[model samples]
Target: MSLLDLDHDQRKELAERVRQDYEELKSKDLQLNLTRGKPSSEQLDISQRLLELPGTEDFKDADGTDVRNYGNLKGIRDIREIWSELLGVRYDELIAGDASSLNMMFDLVMYAHTFGTQDSERPWNQEEKVRWICPVPGYDRHFTITEKLGYEMLSVPWLDEGPDMDAVREAVKDPQVKGMWLVPTFANPSGHTVSQDVARQLAEMETAAPDFRIVWDNAYAVHTLTEEFPEVIDIVTLAREAGNPNRFWHMTSTSKITFAGSGVAFLNTSTENIDWYASYAGARGIGPNKINQLAHARFFGDADGVRQVMRKHASLLAPKFNRVLEILEAELGEYDVARWTTPSGGYFISLDVIDGTAARVVELAKGAGIALTEAGSSFPLHKDPNDRNIRLAPTLPPVAELEEAVRGVATCVLLAAVEKLGA
Candidate 1:
């Protein structure tokens, strides 16, 4: 029965039962974690072949460019082509960089703050206020970048297909709203893929700022749990057709697909934006790790090779995701105290416990030696306005440990909900 439907005495009895369950959970003294969506050791082992790639003596790219040299600011052609096909960008427009896409994202924000975008009248720092549109139940690191820069972040509801279009369209009417953080496909926690209609609206919408931009983070472009991959929108082309040529700064990486510690990052955008980025990026460094780029290129011979790798990833990740769903349903469904996403692809399950009970659930998990991403982490500035959301990562732990941890979390969910009910 729904907890709300239960009588006072029933609630008290149920609370007592859950408290006993909580005590049992703590007594186990388990040290399991579901804090970050890191790939498991088995998942990591799928790409061990990367170690032998572009072997020492065979370090030259297909074009015979020596990868060890400090040149090729645009990165190697072969690597760029593979990602271009996968990311829906032209080969010439893509720039392969070092491991982390987060680094590239940070750099772009700093670059814009100091130098402005290709279309900007002045640097972002010179402006009085720079507001960013952040889709809630989104990526935390994306929010952290703008937060660390002292910029204001506005929250927008992320619907099943994408962010609430009407809200985003209105937000951009203010000149202070400069950029937005978006993960177009299989988004971080919610796994809300942006539909073509939404993508077009974002591209075509009129805005007050000439320099309005979107950080098109395709972090999970090919990271699908299902066999059918999500569609990739031709965003840059759509923007150009809409007369907003420099509207997006695309970023992607193989950190999850291959070796997380050593992976190739990609940046794709308009021709003008590329030129603008190169002028500034060139001043900062000679080039990215071309040797590493060559190694990645050799590992994934083509676009299909990347998809094939993602399938291996799916084989390992799908079960953990399923187990979490099954546990959540079995433990929390009857009480109607929790709801979660059943994602076709993505690393996280966006769990929402009873209203105002997320922090309590997380706290309860912590007391029982289970580590979860902090409550409210999915929002800008680490604040969930309703305090109703939690991001659960199931990819990192073994299925056995994941099941136990999720059961503990479900127990905490019930305990917290009942506590809130009594209050």
Candidate 2:
């Protein structure tokens, strides 16, 4: 039965029972964490062969370009081809670089901030006021980037289909809305995918900002928890067909695919935009780490090789996600105190506790030695106005520990909900 149906005395009885459980949890001295969505050791081990890849003598691309030397600002073609086929971009258009896609994003934004994009009338820093459309229940790190750069991050509903297009369309009518961040495939906390219809709409829509850009961060483009991989939208083509050739600054990385610490990152865009990025990027460095790029290319001979490995990842990850869902269903099913996403792919399970109680739930879980992604982490400025959403990372923890942490989270949710009522 829903907790709302309980009378005051019944509610009091329940609260005491839950509180007792919470106190007992604290006494157990548990130390379980579900905070960051990091790949497990086993997942990392799957690609262990990468450590010996592109060995000392094999440091040159098929084109006979020595990777050890510093000069392919566009990176080695072999690595670019791997992701290019997977993400559906042309080989020459995809530029490979260091491990972190986030860094690539930062550099892209910094470039525009300082010098403006292909169609910019003036640099973003010189604009009277700059705003960015950020979908709520998004990656915190994405929000961190914009906040650091002083962009007034506007909230758009991140729905099952994708960001609410009507809202996005309305928001972009203002030219000051320079750009937006999108995790198009299996988005960070929500595990949502942008439908082709939505993709087309976003591409075709008119924006007041001549140089408006979409930071299409397809971080989980291949990070699935199921057999079927979601479609990798041809966003670059979509925008170009829409006459917004410079619309998206597409990015992806092999950080999770190979070594998290050292994998290749990529950026794909129109000819004009790619050249613009190269000009700004060239002044900063002679070239990216081509040796690492070469190693990654050899590790995954082709796009199918990348797919074969992700299937292994899905095998290991699916179970943890399933266990988390099972526990959430069993523990919180009756109370109607919360609801969460059942994502087929992506690193997080976005949980929403009772309204005005998410922060309380996190606090309660922490007291019981359970760590969760901070409350409001999936929003602009790290503030969930209703205090209802919490992001759970099931990938990092072992199954046994994940269960403990999630169960504890359920207890906290229950206690927080009842306390809000009992008072």
Candidate 3:
């Protein structure tokens, strides 16, 4: 019988069976982790050539500026130029930084609240409270950043096309809504690419807050598993054309493309925003590590080289993704206890279990010696009111381990669903 259709006694029996299986599995000394959205060792190896690019007297920019010494607060010119091509933005509009674009975004919010942006009439701190529109089933780190800053977060349901634009429009009408976080291309966890129509509507929407900006974190811009994926219209261009020139603060990084801990990151926006942010950012530090930028520039050479590198990543990752899908199909297809997203590209497979069962499933998986990202992490404030969403990361583990992990997760889901129904 399906877990949902099981009687109380049957469910109790099923739970006991699952518990016994988990105990046996845990005692097998198997080590498998499928929690974080991290790339595998083989994926990291693809960019190993970057380390050799800046050896034996090659540490200067084209203008004779020493790459090792710090001065350009907005990054070296050539590095910006390279990223501009990758991000589909102009070089002058981009501000390349160190490996942490997320850190930069946090600083942006903090600065806005304390001192405001160039266009603001007053600092956000003087206001009653600042608010942000958080799309549900989004990146946990994105929500955590806003919550930690004490900004009032309003959760908006994310559709396959993107976030519900109607809700977005209504939310932004409130004067306290200062910003919204978005991952437009193959978004984190959900892997839903924002539709072109939705992108345009978001750009053109009227907001009561004059300084409202879209915190567009394109963390997985080029990390695609399939060539048949939808093409993302450059939101910067769309926003500018829609007469909202400063509507977006775009960010990207090579964390997944190169070494996760040491890759370069960048932000792109309108000229006015760039000038203001540069002036503010310069007060703190001299600049990002130019040597790293030079190394990446040499390693990738140009945009085409970067695309070639992504193809290698796709080859390594596609099978792992398919394996998870295969296991899900084999174990849970007929029972219908949950549904999942089959993304064309991106780093995650988002699963939606029965309401109020996700936390139990995660606990059961842990008992079986398999780790997962904490349940409800995909939602704002780590609160999934329905307790339904779970993000499955398949890229980090080997194919065999991923298969085993998927089976374990499937078993957990069945156990949890059955118990919930019985209760």
Candidate 4:
């Protein structure tokens, strides 16, 4: 029977039994971790050729520009060409550089703070208070950026369709609400993909802030862990059609596609924003690491090559995700005390345990020597108001370790539920 279905005596008895089991688990001293969505050693090994790419003899790009040199602010055209096809934007429009998309995102926010975008009348930092719409049960790193930069984050409900568009439409009526972050495909923590209709609405929605921007961090556009890859509408096209040519800045990276830290990052948007970014970036540095760009270009060779590489990634990743789902089903399926997403593509499984039990479950897991993504990590300010959501990252651990880690989580979930029901 479900925890809620049991009588007070039964719940109390169950809680005691669960507590004993949890104590026994703690004695094992297991050091398994599911804290981050880092790639496994096997995953990293797949891209080993990248380390020795563009071998000694060949260092020139398609245009014969010596990649070893220090200039090509817009990135090498050949590399841009390759990403453009995958991103569905024009080849010349992409600005390729930086190993981390997060770094590029920070620079954009800093630039907006210091100098403002083309449409902004004044710098963001100068404003009394700048706010951005945050889709909850979302990426923690995205929220951290806004928080660190002093941006007031307005939490919006992330629906199956995407962030609640009606709420987003209403939230933007306030003039100080500068913009919002968009993780369009296989979003972090929750694997909700933004449908084309939602993408169009976000691009065209009326806003009080004339320079409202969509920090489109399409980090997982190509990181599908399934055979069925879903594509999103072109935001740039939709924004321009809606008379807001510069409404969004699209950022993506090959961090998971190739080497996580040693991969190429990209930013694409309107020609106007591209020029604005280039002018500011030119002042920041001469150019990006073109050698890295060349290496990636050589490693993939073309867009199709990139797709083939991702398929290989899916092969390795899908099984781990399936294992987590299977364990949750076997252990907690009949409890009626928990629910989790069966994502088609993404690095995580977003789990929602009984209300007010998520934190306790995480605590129990930690005591048992299994490290999980801290409760509330998927929300803004590291706070899940409901205290019910837990993000399960299955990518970092080996299959054998993941099985144990997930079972431990299931045990914690059951224990916490019983304890809460007992009370």
| 2 versus 3: better TM-score goes to | 2
What is the alpha-carbon RMSD of candidate 1 to the true structure? 0.9
TM-score of model 2 (CA atoms): 0.99
Q: lDDT per model, in order? A: 0.91, 0.90, 0.86, 0.88
Distance from true location, Cα of 67 in model 1, Å: 0.8
How many steric clashes does model 2 contain? 0
Cα TM-score per model: 0.99, 0.99, 0.95, 0.98
lDDT of 4 at 132: 92
Candidate 3 clash figure, as a count: 0
Assess the local accuracy of residue 83 in candidate 4 as a C-alpha lDDT between 0 and 100: 91
Task: Give per-residue CA lDDT, model 3, range 199-296, as digits (tens).
Answer: 88998888998899899988888888976434646778788888888889999898899999998988888888888887778887888898998888
In the range 1-423, model 1's lDDT, one tens digit per residue, is 899999988898999999999999999999999999899999999989888878979888889878888898888998999989987777777898889998988988899999998789999999999999999989999999999889899999999889999999999999999999999988889888999999999999999999999999999988999898888787888998998889988899999999887998888899899898889989999999988888888888999999999999999999889989999999999999999999999898999888899999999999999999999999998999999999999999899999999999999999999999882
Ten-residue region with minimum lDDT total, candidate 3:
226-235
- The TM-score, computed over Cα atoms with residue i paired to residue i, of candidate 4 is 0.98
- The C-alpha stretches of model 4 lying farther than 4 A from their native spots are none
lDDT tens digits, residues 1-423, model 2? 889988888888888899899999999898999999899999999999988988977988978998888898988888787788898887767888888889999999998998888788999999989999998889899999899989899999998799999899999999999999999988989899999999999999999999999999998999989999989998999999999889998898988887788888888888888899899889999999998888888888999999999999999999999999999999999888899999999899999888899999999888889988889999999899899999999998889988888999999999999888853
